[model samples]
Target: MATTKEYRLGEFTFPRGWFMIATADDINSYKPRQIRFFAHDFVLYRGRESGKPVLLDAYCCHMGNPLGAKNTTSYVVRDNGGTNIEGDCIRCPYHAWRFGPDGKCNQIPYSKDPIPESARIKAWRVVESMGAIWIWYDPEGGAPEWDAPALAEWDDPAWVTPKWDNVGMLAQHPQEVVDNISDYAHLGPIHGSTVDRYENEFRGHLAIQRQCGGHRTLVAADGTRSILHTITTYHGPGVLISDLTGLYDAKLLIMHTPVEDGSIQIWHSLVVKSPSGAAKAGITDAVTAAQFQETSLLSFAQDFEAWTVKAPCINGMFVPSDGPFMKQRTWYKQFYNPRAKERDYLDRCEGVYVPKGVVPYSEATVA
Candidate 1:
C-alpha cells in the first residue's frame, strides 16, 4: 500500500479536518457502532438521554477490551444488568469499567479503589451536520477553527432530500482523489466534458475549483450539449461540496475519510430541485428525486471505476492546460503541517483565481 510519504504529501500522515465517519441515521441509542479511520478504532454512539453524538477510542483503558464489541459475553453487558451503556457512558465488556463521554474512566465495579487519572481514553470532537456525522481530527489535538460548509439548499423546500451512496473503501490515497478537482485535462477523456474556462482558488484551508464546461454525453436526446457551470469547494482535506448548474440545479456531497495509510472510504450524495415545488406543500416526491439521483450516481461511478484501477500518481508531468495541480497540492499540505509551518507552504505556492461578482444561476456570466 502506498503511504502519504511516498506521494510526498507533507509532514503529517493524516490531514486535519472535519471528515465524515457515518450518516446521522447510522447511530442511535440502541447500541454503539464500531468504526475504523486514520488507522485507529473508534466507537460511535448517541447519548441515550442527551441525544447528542459521541466518538471515543474503542479500547478500554483498564484491560484493553473493545467497548463496542459485538457477539461477546462480557461483564460490561452480561453482568452489568445486560446493558453495556448507561446514559452517555459505555462500560467495558471485560472488566465492567465505565467511561464517560469525556473519555475518563468513571466507574470500576466491585473495586473499592478510586479510578486512576491514567484510566482514560481519547475522545474526539464530533458534530452532526449536513445529514452526516463529522469528526474533527487534529494530530496536534486542537479544536476546530472553522465551520463546515453549509448546504443552504438542504433546508429549501424547493429541493428534495439528499440521496447518498456509500462507495466503500478504495486502495488509494486521498491526495490522488483530491487532485481530480483541478485536473482539467481529464474532463474530456474521463467524464466526456469539454472545458471552456477553468480556475482554482486557495483560501486558507479552503480550495475552490470553478469549471465552465459542456457535457457531450449527458445531454438531451437531440444531442444538444448543455453547458455545465460548477463550483467545487474543499472545506478542508476531507469534505467536498460541489454546486452544479446547467441541466439541473444540483448539489453533490463527496466525503473521503482515510481508513488506513493508503486506503480511504468514500461517500457521495446528490440533491436536485423539484419541478412541481410540491415540497413547499409539505410533500416530498421520492420518485423524481430517485430518478435524478440515478443519473448523478452514474456519472460519479465513472470516476470511481477509473480511480480504483489506476496506480497511485506519486509524481506527474505537467502541461499548461492541466490546471493548478501544484498550487492545490501546496494548499493541501497546510493540513498536514502544524499551524506554524502552514505559512511556509503558502509562501512558496501561488493561489488560483476565483471569479468575483458572478451569480451562480446565470449561464451568461460563466465566460
Candidate 2:
C-alpha cells in the first residue's frame, strides 16, 4: 500500500468531503460504537435524548480514556445497565466525565473545580441518511461545502431498498478507486463489457463517467442480459452513485471511506425499481432487488480483486485511449488541498472528455 504523500495528492492525507463512518444499523441499538476513519478513532452513537447520530473524538480529554470502548467493570456501565451512555451524553468509563453532544464536559463528579473549557473532545458534524451515517470530514476543519448524500428514490415506495453489502476493508488508497471513473479499457476486460460508447467529465467535485454496452454480468431476474447504460458520479471524494439502465432501472451505490492513509472500507447497495412496475414494492420485489444487488456486488468485486494487490500508480504510463487518467487525478486533487485552491484545480480539469477512438456518450464536446 502507498501513502498519500507517495501519490503527491496535496496537504491532507485524507480528502475533504462527506464520508460514511458507519451504517445506520450499526447504531440501531443506541449503543456507543467505536469507529476508526481518517486515521483517527471516534465514538459514534445515536443520542438517546435527541435521537440523532453523534460522532466525537473517541478518547476523553481527562486521563485519555476511550468513552466508547465497551466496559462491563466500570460502575458507570453497570449502573447504566451495560452502557455509559446518558441520554445524548456519554460518561467516561474511567473518570465518569460526562460529555455532551457538543463534546464539552458538562458534568464532573466529585471534583468541584470549574469545568475547564479544555475538558472536551472534538465533535464531528454528522448526518444520518439512507441507512448510513456520514461525517463531513475536512482536514482544514471547514464547514461542509455540500449537504450529506441522499437518494430521491430512497423514500419512494416503488423502489426496493436493498440492504448494504459489506465489501469489507481494502488496503489501498482511494485515489486508485476513484480512477475507475475514467477507466474505459477496463470495461471490456474486467467487466466483460462490449462498450459501444464511453466518455468522462470532471466538474468541480464531480468526476463522472457515461457508458453503455452489453455486459456479461448483472443479468435480469429471468436471466436476461441486455445493453447496460450507466451514468456514474462521485458525489465528493467517497460517495459514488450510479444510475443504471438495462436489466433493471436501478440506483447503485459504491461508497468508500478512508480508514487510514493507505486503506479504506467499502459498501455497495442497489435500490432497484420494482420489477412488476407496482406502485409499491412487495416481498417479491425485495427478493429480486437483493439478487440484483448480489450481482452488482460481483461486478464490483472484479475491480476489488485487482485493487487488492496492484502496485500504486504513483505515476501511470497513461495513454489517450486509456481514458483521461491525468484529468481525473487532477479533479481528485482538489479535495486533498485547501478550499482556496479548489478553483485552481477545477480550472485545470473541468470539462467533458471522450477517450481516443471511442464515440462520445453524448455528441457535445468541450475544449
Candidate 3:
C-alpha cells in the first residue's frame, strides 16, 4: 500500500492580492467589455489618442447607464471609443451626467451647479504588463505596490508575444486552478501534448522572496525529484511566469482572477526558447506566435471540462495523484498567516472560505 502523506483540507488561505481580469488584447478588439468580479463591475476601454488602457466602473455616474454600450455606442468618443466626452469627461446615456476617468462627476447635463464629491465614483489604479491589465483591491486607501516580476525576453525584440486567450472553468473557488498547477500527475493524461514527458519527483522547501518590483518568486526545491521550479508571480495576485525546467525553455505566464465564487477568468501565455537551425526551417515568429495562442487555449479548455465536472470544492475528497496538490496547499499559506509565523493556517481557521467579494481586511491580519 502507498504511504499516505500529511495533507489537510482548508490548510491555507488563498493570497489576497490584485487579481488580473483581462488581457490587453481583449480591450484592443474594439469591444467595451465589463468583467464582474468581487461583486463589482469594471469596464475596460482603450484610451483616446494616447492608446493607454483605462479601467473604471461600468455605470455612468449621471443616471447609472452603462458607460460603454456594447455593439451600439461603440464605447468610443473623441478619437477614443465611448460616449460623448465634453472635456476629459464621459457622459451618461440616460441623463448625460459627465464623469472623468477618476469616477468624479464632472458635469450635470441639466444642472448648472457643480456636482458634490460624494456623487463621484472613484477609479482604481490600472497597471499594464506582459500585454495584460491589472487592478488592485486595496481597501485601505493605499494601493498594493506594483510588482512586475522579471520575465525572460519579455521586451526582447527577437521574441514576439502572441495575443492572449481568455479561459474559464465552471467552478467556484480559485484554488481549483492552483490545485491544477500543483497536480503534476494529471499532466500526462490531461495535457499530454507538451506535458507528457515532464516528471515531478522533487520535494523541497518552498521559499518565497519578494522582489524589488513588489512581486514575488516562490522557489520550491525537492532534492529527490532533482528539479527546481521558480514561479515568477505578480502583484495582481497572479502568476506572471513559471521557470520550471529552465530559463526560456517551456515557460508559462498565467493570469487568473475570479469572475465570481465559482467562475474564473484565466489568460495563459508562453515563451519558448529557440533551437539551433530551427529558424532556417521556417519556424518563424508568426508560426511560433500562432502556436502559443492555439495550444495554450486548448490546454485550458481541457482543464475546464475536467474541473467543472470534478467537484465544487476539491478539499472534500482525496486522490492518489494528489501529491503535488498536497505540496501546493503548503505554499498558499504564505499570504494570510498573520505573524507569517505559521506554516499552515487552514488548520487553525476551520470553516473558512476566502471567497471573492469578502473583504480581505475582515479576515485575520497578515503579519
Best by TM-score: 2
lDDT measured at residue 140 in model 3 versus the true structure, 0 to 100? 43
Candidate 2: tens digits of C-alpha lDDT, residues 158-179:
9998788889999999998999
lDDT score for residue 330 of model 2:
89
Off by over 4 Å in 1: 79-83, 217-225, 278-284, 353-367
lDDT of each prediction vs. the true structure?
A: 0.80, 0.90, 0.50
**Which candidate gets the maximum lDDT versus the true structure?**
2
Counting only residues 3 or more apart in sequence or on different chains, how many pairs clash (N, Cα, C under 3 Å) in candidate 3? 15
How many pairs collide in each candidate, listed in order? Answer: 0, 0, 15
lDDT of 3 by residue, 1-367 (tens): 0001112223223344566767777775345566686557877766555566667788776567777665343333533444454343455556666667677777775787767777776587777776777776543445454454445456654555455656653444566665654454454477542121222221222222111111011111333323223343332235545653322244567767656544566777775545222432235754755664465567567877787776554443555534334444544443433323443443432221222222222232222
Q: Where does candidate 3 have its weakest 10-residue lDDT segment?
A: 210-219
Q: Residue-wise lDDT of candidate 1 within 1-367, one digit each (tens)? A: 4899997877789999999999889988657889999999999999888888989999987778788768346655765466677898888877678889999999887789877899899999998877789999999888886886567787777788775688888999998889887777777887887766677777887888887767854444454437777888888899898887756677888899999989999998877777455656234455666666777777888898988898887788876556678788888888888988888877766466433333222343543
Alpha-carbon runs more than 4 Å astray in model 3? 1-15, 28-31, 71-82, 85-88, 139-141, 145-152, 192-237, 244-248, 275-283, 296-300, 314-327, 330-367
What's the candidate order when arranged by decreasing lDDT? 2, 1, 3
Taking every candidate in turn, the Cα RMSD to the unseen true structure, in Å, is: 3.4, 2.5, 11.2
Q: What is the lDDT of residue 42 in candidate 2?
A: 97
